[model samples]
Target: MLFDLARPLLFLLDAEVAHELVLPSARLAHRFGLSGLPGGPLPGRQVNAMGLAFPNPVGLAAGFDKNAAFLRLFAAFGFGFLEIGTVTPRPQPGNPKPRLFRIAAARALINRMGFNNCGIARFVENVRRARYDGILGINIGKNAATPIERAADDYVACMQAVYPLASYIAVNISSPNTKDLRELQRGTALEGLLDALGRERRSLARKHNRRVPIAVKIAPDLEDDAIPAIAERFLAHEVDAIIATNATVSRAGLAGLPHADEAGGLTGAPLRARATEVVRRLAAALQGAIPIIGVGGILSGADALERIDAGASLVQLYTGLVYRGPALVREAVAAIEPQAARMAA
Candidate 1:
């Protein structure tokens, strides 16, 4: 009800401006003890994955709270888990202004906002201040200026900084906005990255006396032939989970829509099928050896279930939240609860 009232007004402003306004306002609402959604947290079936338990399988994907500044506010809205960042080793202004675009008609978004973030130092500080003890996943990415060859260093640095705080660590090598970053998803680059991160995790586990799970986020734009090999690499490297997709560079269905040709990744409804297919492919390749966190274009209860049917152990929302409001979280949990029960049975 509140979101419906505010949707039209929010839609009235520039996309990024509306985004900036919404976060703080929502945080304020949370601070006042107001439920940010129509109801408070939804009842969900517990899920055990990555050696951590999730209250539900519906999560807010990375990018929404990139800096970890609004963890409590989002938690109030009933996500089973929350993933924050794509934060780098250093702060950097993202792509030039007007980087985010909303296509109301298609219920889609296109963004090339390079991994603009307050660097890992400030990001850690923000997380520490939030004191949020939920099942949090901290996503890390290489600095824009970091040469592609040395991206592993950035990932290791971030993992070391957040390992104690994160329920899991998500390695983001798939955002199309980062130049050549996607290359890390392929061939020897993929091997080296997994190997490096694997070595680091072993050392960190011994140092911290805890084994934090590592989930690799991939792009949805890969050729069909590439997925199995990617899955193979993940399995061989012992990746705890695979985030089945990041945004896509493809503009398949939005041929005539506004902002359809934007250079950045295309997300929301336009990428739904492709993202699910990627999950399906990963599932086939992984054959249950590894769990999958399905995301990209999930906008409703049915979409969430579809990802689960395709073998996603969990589902996440980003663009869906933009279109459906916090209510979508409840809807997704409701949709998945029965299936979860059946599985448990």
Candidate 2:
């Protein structure tokens, strides 16, 4: 309700400006424990997946708190887990401004922000400085100018930099904005990238005496054949998990909505069915060979449970939280508990 009231004022500014401006205030709210001011039943629930124990399964996805900027805020809002970055090894300006668009009618967003971030070093510093006590995942990407052929090196470098601080690391090979980024999802290319990171995971584990999970985030804009192939490669390479279905480049789901023609990834309600389908396909292929973290189009408790029923062990949210606010999280978590009890029965 507060966010809805603020949206008229927020929407008046550039989308990106509203994003940066809102986060700091949220952080301040966290500092003062203002987040607890709203009266409600506490939503603290424990969930275990991917060999890590999450306080709850609802998490803020990669793009929201890029560079780990709003950990305190998201933690305060009761997210069980928080992911930050799509950070490259070195800093680079993403696509020009005006890259973020809100499709209010559809409760969707179309963005080509291009992974603009403060790079791994800055990200490490910020994350190290944050006071959040929940799970943190780091999403890493390659530089926009990096050739597709050399993408493995970039992923490895990012892993090396963030491994110490990250509870888990997400290899973001799905963002549509970077030139040829999705190409890494193809057969031989995908194997090579995962193999390189797999080797590093072992090396880091031996050095630190702790193994951090590595999850691959893939796009929903894939052929049926591609999903299984990627899953097989994941099993073969021993990749820890998969974030089944990132933002969709195919606008087939949101055809008549405003900005449906927007030239970037599509997320929100229109993304629900297709993203759910992707999670179902992945679950069939992997058969829980490894856990799948479902992303895309989750705006309600039923929506979150539908993804879990479709075979996701956990779920992440981005656009839905933007459209619905923190109440959505509580409702979704509340919804999950009853279903979880029934499943146990």
Candidate 3:
């Protein structure tokens, strides 16, 4: 109701400006005990994955809270978990302004923000300040200036830094905004990168006396045949989970729409089929060997169930929150509870 009232006004501003305004404003509302401002909590069943118990299966994906500044604000919206960052070892301004575009007609978004973040140091400090004890997933990425060949070094550094703090660490090598980052997803590159991170995790586990799980995020723009092989690599490397997709570069159904030709990832309603297809394929390839975190195009309860039906152990909301507002989270949670119960039965 609140969001429906605010949508027209928010849509009146530039997409990025509206985004910058909302997070802080919402945080203020949360601080004032305006609990109903985000949305009242909905019932959710517990889901266990990656060795951690999720209060619910709906999560806020990374990129929303890149700096980890609004943890509690989003937590109040009732996500089972919140994944923050795509932060690098150092700060970056990201791509120039006007990078985030809204396709209102299609309920989708295109962004080439290029992982602009406050760097891991500030990110870690912010996370510490939030003191949020929910199931937190920290997503780490290499700096844009870093050479592609040495991306593993950046991932390792980020892994070590957030390992102790994260309920699970998400290794993001799939964002199309970064140059050559996707190359790391290929054969030898994937193996080499996983091998390095595997070594670091073993060490971090011993040092922290806790083995924090690592989930590798991949891009949706991959050959159908490529998924099985990628699944094989994940299984071989013992990756705790696979975030079936990041945003996509393909502009399949948006040929004549505004921002249809943007050079970054396309997410929201348009991404539903592709993202779910990837999850379906990963589920088939993984054959329950590893868990899959399905995201993209989940704008309603039915969309959430679609991902689950396709074998996503969990689903996440981003662009959906933009179009549907906070109510989407509760809707998704309510939609999936029966399925979760059936599975338990």
Candidate 4:
């Protein structure tokens, strides 16, 4: 109600500026205990995946709270978990201003903001100070300047810093905004990167005496034949899960629309089908060998459930939150209730 009314006003600001202003303000409200998670069919939606218990299957996707600074507030909004960051080892400014563009008619977004973030060190500090105590999944990525071949080094560095703090660490190798990052998703490259991450995860597990799960986040633009091979690598390397998609480079559904030709990954309603298809493919290939966190174009309860029906153990919201506000959270949980009930039964 309130958000819908405020949507037009917020929409007046540049997308990125509105994002900058809204999060901290919302965090302040949550900090003061003025915020509350809304209701639907979410009360009994607890789920256990990757060895962690999630209160619900709906989570706020990465890129929303990249530094984890608003965990307490975001956690209050009814997410089962939160994936923060695509943070690199060091801070970089990402791309220039006006990098984020909105396609209001299509309820979509195209961002080539690069991986703009406050860097791993500051990100860890933010996580340390956060009062929220839910399942926190930190997403790690390579710095824009890092060579594609040495991407493992950047990812390893971020994993080392965030391992203890994150409930799970998402290895993001598929953000189209970064140069050559998606190359890490190819056959031999994917296998080797997974190997390096697996080896490092083992050593870190010993040192920290806690084994944190690692999930690979992939792009949605993959060919139909490529998914099974990726699933094979995931199993061989023992990855804890696969975040079925990041965003897509294709604009299949947004023909002749504003910002349609924008360079960056396209997300929101336009991405729902493609991303769900990836989840479906991955599910068939993995045959339950590993879990999939379905994300991309989740703008409503039904959209969230579509991922579940297609075989996502969990679903996440990014662009949807931009379009629908917090109400989308509870609705997603409600939408997924039947699936959770069936599993429990």
Q: What value of lDDT does candidate 4 attain over all alpha carbons?
A: 0.87
lDDT of each: 0.90, 0.83, 0.90, 0.87
Q: Kindly give the stretch of ten consecutive residues in candidate 2 with the minimal lDDT sum.
A: 36-45
Clashes of 2: 0
| Candidate 3: Cα lDDT at 258 | 85
* Residues 1-345 of candidate 4: C-alpha lDDT, one tens digit per residue: 556776898899999998898887776766675555442224537778999988889998999988777777777777788889989999999999888989999999999989888999999999998756778899999998988888889999999999989899999989999988889999677877888899999999999999999999999988899899888888888999999899899988789888799889999998999999999999999999889999999999999889999999999999999999998887888788866644533
* lDDT per residue as tens, model 3, 1-345: 667777899999999999998888778867887646433234477789999998889999999999999988888898889999999999999999999999998999999999999999999999999899888999999999999889999999998889889999999989999999999999788989999999999988899899999999999999999999999988999999999789999998898998898788999999999999999999999999989999999999999999999999988889999999998887888889966534533
Q: Write the residue-wise lDDT of candidate 1 on 205-274 in tens digits.
A: 9999999999999999899999998889888898999997899988888888888887899899989999
Top-lDDT structure, candidate number: 3
lDDT of 2 by residue, 1-345 (tens): 556677688877877798888778766765776654222222444667778997667777899988887776777665778888899999988998888988888888899999899988998898889865578899999998888999999999999998988889999999989999999998788888988999999999999999999899999999988888889988898888899778888777566777778788888888899889999999999977898999899999899989989998888888887777777777666666765433423
RMSD of 3: 2.5
- Decoy 2 TM-score against native: 0.93
Q: List the residue pairs that clash in candidate 4.
A: none
Q: What is the lDDT of residue 48 in candidate 4?
A: 89
Off by over 4 Å in 3: 35-42, 338-345
- lDDT value, candidate 3, whole model: 0.90
The 10 consecutive residues of candidate 3 with the worst lDDT sum are: 34-43
Predicted candidate 2: what Cα RMSD to the true structure? 3.0
